[model samples]
Target: MIFFYTARAKFNNENGADILAWTNYIEWSKLTQLTELVSIDTSINEVLVETDRTSEEDWKEIVIDGYHETGFYRTLDHVLKKKILKDLIS
Candidate 1:
């Protein structure tokens, strides 16, 4: 499966800090691909994933878990590059 994702930072008034939030748009041709990618690329201790199977769109929503926003972004960049290269070669 191929997935597309975007992330952003939002300010938390109560905490007076910025939090990392990511929204993953997944192409569900293969269900396990995202899991595999996340497992291999990240070492985040607790991961939470929620899927919206009821939507009638081609892309489904997936939320990835990570406390370190910058680290997650770096991992995402690396994974995307690897996927692109694999796609191009094959």
Candidate 2:
């Protein structure tokens, strides 16, 4: 199961306001949705930061199908949660 975090903006422009108010909202979604968005807009790759989840064969297949090409390949070293917390506190 692949999961991803998406951060988006909520805007309010009620009562004929001259300016817009916006708030940042974050949510979690499955890989399927992400692939759908990618299929619609390939430009998303500019801001996409994929993690180590692509290393698995099943995950890789889904990504390749979504991307419609095999050229976009990347790998990053996986990190442990304990090490991440230790670094954060120190």
Candidate 3:
């Protein structure tokens, strides 16, 4: 199944460059925190993702196992993105 996620950074009155720089600096390892934040299954296949990056918005494709069997979509959204960013920064 195909899943979409919007990645965002929390910057205080920062310009586009700052935000984009912050996002680019984000590590992929930090993103794995979603497995617990969203309660994702570890048995899922290797994730296939497509990222559309821009200064303002960053959209990503996430492939998770059991996306169809479970209501996984319920946990994947803007909130999840915010949490990921938070986890990345903190």
TM-score (all chains, Cα) for each model? 0.20, 0.19, 0.18
Report the C-alpha lDDT of model 3 over 1-90, residue by residue, as the tens digit: 745443332322143334443344344345523322211332322222223245233322332455432312223564466555666777
In angstroms, give how far residue 12 of model 3 lies from its true place: 12
Error of 2 at 33 (Å): 27
Better of 1 and 2 by TM-score: 1
Q: Given candidate 1, what's the lDDT at residue 26?
A: 30
Instruction: Tell me how far candidate 2 lies from the true structure as C-alpha RMSD in angstroms.
Output: 12.2
> Model 1: how large is the Cα RMSD against the reference?
17.5
Q: Write the per-residue lDDT of candidate 1 for residues 7-77, one digit (tens) a residue.
A: 32222222333223121223333343343233323332222221224633212223335532322322355
Which regions of candidate 1 fall more than 4 Å away from where they truly are?
Answer: 1-74
lDDT of 2 by residue, 1-90 (tens): 643232211222332322321111112332322212323233332223323455564254323546464333322322233235445777
In order, what lDDT does every prediction score?
Answer: 0.33, 0.31, 0.36
Residue pairs with backbone atoms closer than 3 Å in model 1 (clashes): none
User: Candidate 3, residue 11: CA error in Å?
Assistant: 10
Pairs in clash, predicted candidate 3: none
Scored against the true structure, residue 80 in model 1 reaches a CA lDDT of 55
Best by lDDT: 3
